[model samples]
Target: MREVVLVVLQLARMTVTDLLGSLNLPEEHIQYWLNRNEALHNFCSQNETCYSKYELNNKQCWGYEASCSKKDSFSARKAKCTKPNSWQKQIFKKQADFAKLAEVLSTITPICVSNYSEGSSLECSSHLRFCRAKNIFFDFHNLNAKNSKRYRNDVIQKGQAGGNCNMLFNEAALRSRADEKSYLQSWAHELEHFSSYPTFEVSKRQCDVIFEKPTVLIKLDAASSMYHHFCDFVNLYASQHVNGSVDMDIDILWWDTVSFLAAASPKPLIIHYARNCERASEPSALATVIANKNCG
Candidate 1:
């Protein structure tokens, strides 16, 4: 497994020394590799392309058009541009697949039609299909082109506005600050929250077809921060009840957040903390650690 991981990193043109420095591995483990100078030299010599551009290091190559440095390998430059594009498609597909699953779940379960015809309640009922189906109500707001400025001014004057379970998605804010890929990622973050409905859990086997495996794996700090917020909310709500009573219905919210972040992280570091947060007997401590680590 170590060798396979190393090979993948090498192919991506990442230095093993840099990888070791980033990780919390022991000094002895680092020494073991350093001591094997002959073996290491042979390995690197056989995979010279991993360390340098080799045959493609010349100015004629596409990657060398701007910089003729050997460090700017053809494969590395190609990978750098293509990896993000690939992940963007994967993230968008993941959101679409989850939306389909939510639609299927809504059909199987009973939906509670809202009596209120005009307002945030009605909007929430329409957008959050499964949530309303379960008789769980929440406010939904879309701060778009027409309302973004007014909403921001109101928020500044009255302080941050939100209600219990309320979801406020600012499409304009996301568009103004984030690029297309990041915007899609933000949508994926919201879709993850919607997929955590209890009705979806009842059909776990069927849902597994779409949700079991990750479609994308990348380190997204925004997505990580969102997951941390979800986790923190769960822990805070649980603490409000006497004797640490928790509503099991809401467990899916944070659990799905964990799953999404685990899949989204480039390494297993966030996954490790997320799993620990999930299993901890007490709240706040482990969850706080994860929130601090990711949100920082």
Candidate 2:
């Protein structure tokens, strides 16, 4: 189905949101589709096989250190990457737990993306997740590492990288540039990686488990400052609307083809006009989502 293709694109590291921007899809139409779509759930269940890290020995093993600088540079370079039997055994033991993780997310779909998330600075998101048509960007900033670090580190000095917000979803356990998550400090902030292509869909049952309060939000301009403006906007909206919660999911897009999915779906989707701000500033003006939506 259309969702399946989107998942393939994500697995391939493409950005669906960017792809859509290139097409003639209306932003609201895309949002409407996202508000009522099933592809995200399918992709999550289908692509579960790729969620885990690939042990170094699976393809061709290498003893590259943390920096991936070859220490020996001899057979180390040629070492085949293989599945760690011990790790596999552990996974089997933890199958129940892992299944639980998926079960929780099995019903949720990412309707759209917002690339506007710059912490207190008022900058827009480098990228955002969108539903087929829904504009799910109001809180996109909360889901952004770039925005969080840019703001949090400035205050807490946690040493996390600024603007590096894709959640590090590489399945092969490749050395990632992302730092650890504030919640899962021991583990790299890899959970956010699922946000790129989107890993789960909130089913009715899951919805009961997790409550999502939706609202309108602006995607921040990566380097631009809009913090004060956003706060003011939130207050302004809250005065008129009771549904204002100022929460949105922020994530990265691993693939580029993700931008094209709009051609198949009838629903309107919300996505960055180009790549997420995580990668670039919004085009001087809304150019073409297709031409400018490059991940590289």
Error of 1 at 245 (Å): 43
What TM-score does structure 2 among the candidates reach? 0.18
The clash count for each model shown is 0, 93
Reference-based lDDT, residue 231, model 1: 51
Model 1, runs deviating above 4 Å: 1-72, 76-173, 177-268, 271-296
RMSD of candidate 1 to true structure, Å: 22.6
Give all TM-scores, in the order shown.
0.17, 0.18
| Weakest ten-residue segment in model 1 by summed lDDT | 3-12
Per-residue lDDT, model 1, residue 246, is 19
